[model samples]
Target: MHAVLLLMMMVFAAVMTGCSSGPDYKIDIIKELYYQKDKPSPFEIKVTEAGKAVTGLTVTADLSMATMNHGTVKVKFAEGKDGTYAADVKVPMNGKFEAAFLLKKDGEKTEKVIEINVVKPEGVAKINGQWITDKDVSFYKFINQLQLEINRDAARKNYSGKQLEEELAYLDSQEKVLDDQNKLLTQIIRLRSMALLAEEKGHKVEAAEVDAAVEKARGQYAQFASAQALIQHYGEEKFWDVEKQQYKLIVLAQKVQKDLVDQAKKENPKAGDQEIYYQAQKQYEDLLISQINSLKIEIL
Candidate 1:
């Protein structure tokens, strides 16, 4: 009789527990996405339900365009500390790109479409509206590497914990300089794509020139056992790839400037213009150096 009574009680408890539990809430991706700068460029995307948060939700973005093609980027929704779902999608080219977000929860899936324009970049105006080239990234990366080296040196010298911490804090401040430069560069590239096209059409720099520039830059690291080892540490293909890209951009910008000067000369032949092409080339080289410095590039 007692066993029967206990069983009845357990059954009642199980029923009550089921009744107390609430239904799983549903989250829908509402269309709101924006880049850091634009208010209405349609870069905002979100999934929300009752102001709560969701994690591990998958978001995929795809783009359809008449000129450029972009496929989906698989991203998992990362929960913000404040309980919001977020994912980052890097835009590839400037055009109208359609994005779809796929959300999976409780073995069910939901998807939505949001369209955004990959506008040509219009960041802060610098000298001549030059597109931020890969070289800008390289310069920023070089500064980061320098800071790392300095921290390593300070450690080797056996600085006090407090002193080392202070030094590291100072280094941290400089790190953001690169981040800002990178953001600027992204905008510049977007704005100056036309100039880039012109450069791509007119001139090509040889691979050997790029290789030589990279090798010369590596001289600062001669203390390392081998250049190969340094390259391996930095990444064999990636470091060299960045160098190649920078050199190509350099060549491209030079050609574009020359094209401009050439047109000017053609428009006025008897003005005794000193080799406008050569003059343009020199001006571009100087500008490159100035831009590098402005970007706070330091080789540690």
Candidate 2:
């Protein structure tokens, strides 16, 4: 019985030593934390051990704003493509909040805490007061594609060093043009935002109208053998879902522009067709600038 008791005490000491050693991994927040109130704000946390990503871990987050008396909210993080754990959390309001990450792996548990600031966004550049990064990424991707195309053409022509340098300079000029075009596209998005506002105020484009527009667009893709072929060319699900929404937005923008022009005509009955159109265009441009100025647009 004494021998058994001594063995038990030895086991207990070993267990205590193991627990006291703490976790072998380090947890770090990947980037600056800025969240828009009530929006799904995505963040990444990296776990590393000896300069390598620590895999196969279960990570969870608990968030609370102490000063604001906000209660704790729990969030589960999923493993991301780059070996980091990611989560989209919605904070209740605009303020400073504390986020505590609890990580568990192979019966070992560890934790890290971070503070984040949430802010309310302003103006039409935001959708539901949240800044979107998808459009920004898409814009840069397009620019990169343009650069690649230019390089391919230069290579095909067998351009040497000096010629290659000139070609690259020309590509830089083209990039600036594309950048200007992107600015115009952003303005159009702001115009679409105005359309969305109109939608909130009971102005809606009918489903039938959107369906007709989509059908018309499909008709323009006659080079494809069938709708399925067209879908395959531009990703089946994306062509249907994302392209359909894009068509809807286009139709809605058209309707909004027409409404604005009609209002302009009514307000200035003596104005010619060209004058009314120009006035409506100017008004829309001014509105976009106003919206951009008023919005809190943070890229991160």
Candidate 3:
């Protein structure tokens, strides 16, 4: 066990001797095991041999608590792109844990042990190394549904029979897929990046500002019965709790937008509101790209 811990700490050096292999397999951690209770926590790793990726190797892990006596759980890895392999490991709880990885190819068998600290997932991904929590994902899903439900209600009222079915089908077609999920994650990243830039520019998101923004949204949605029903379904207090956090960032971004709009207006004194807004939006996108490039982003 002490030998295992030592090899785990070495990270890139854990290896085994095999007649058919070159330079001993180098195992690297791609993603760590995260705590998900009895649910599967994703663990990813990359395998290399002789300075090149080695594919078609079978891999598995025996997971066990490091500090306490918890029975070992076994998980098998499925091959992924390149030399990457991933496994969904189920653990008894979140804490210090260790995994003993067994890799096999041809007649060669290699074992690599690694220490993994299992904690609650910070986020589905990271922005400048900050975790994007499950809460963020849920809120995005909810807010998107708010508009969809409203449209659904509108279709029910204005269309009937086959026409209604077609409208409903169109709405269903809009349901989120992998691309939409990526888009939402990108949006979350963009908003956060802009908000951080706003703070750097000395814009403050006060509680009053957040409250006002949220209230404005509430008032706008209040006209739609479907919106109200959705809010009720999530519990109004719970809905607003997440919403307020979202609006705080939003308000900060809005401040940045307002600054850009002000700049556009000054430059185009004769421009109408729409023209000014369009200019500001273009500037905002350009600035967002610069910010994203300058920052370190990681998708976990």
Query: Who wins the TM-score comparison?
Result: 3
- For model 3, residues 1-300, the per-residue Cα lDDT tens digits are 999988786764544222334337888877777776557767788999887998999998898999899899898999998899987777888898778878988866777787878887777787766888777877787788888888898899899999999999989887754236677788789999999999999999778888889889999889789899989999999998888988888998989999999999999999999999999999999999999998867564
Model 2 accuracy (lDDT, Cα): 0.67
**By the lDDT metric, which is better: model 1 or model 2?**
2
User: Runs in model 3 with CA error above 4 Å?
Assistant: 1-120, 154-167, 178-180
Off by over 4 Å in 1: 1-172, 181-201, 221-232, 254-300
lDDT of 1 by residue, 218-269 (tens): 6754544444454677776777676566556655565667676776577667
User: Which candidate should be chosen as best, given lDDT against the real structure?
Assistant: 3
lDDT (Cα, tens digit) per residue for candidate 2, span 1-300:
999999999999999887663476677776334456556666677888878888888989888995888788798989975558887777777788888878888888876777776555432133444554455435334534434554546454677688777876776665555545446346445755666655655677788988999888667554334434535655666555655766677776777678779989999999999999999999877765665565544333
- Clashing residue pairs, candidate 1? 32-44, 32-45, 33-43, 33-44, 33-45, 34-43, 34-44, 121-190, 121-191
- On TM-score, who's better, 2 or 3? 3
TM-score of each: 0.32, 0.43, 0.61
TM-score of 2: 0.43
* Evaluation by TM-score, superior candidate among 1 and 2: 2
Q: Which stretches of candidate 2 lie over 4 Å from their true place?
A: 1-32, 35-126, 131-192, 221-232, 293-296
What shift in Å separates residue 266 of candidate 1 from its native position after superposition? 15
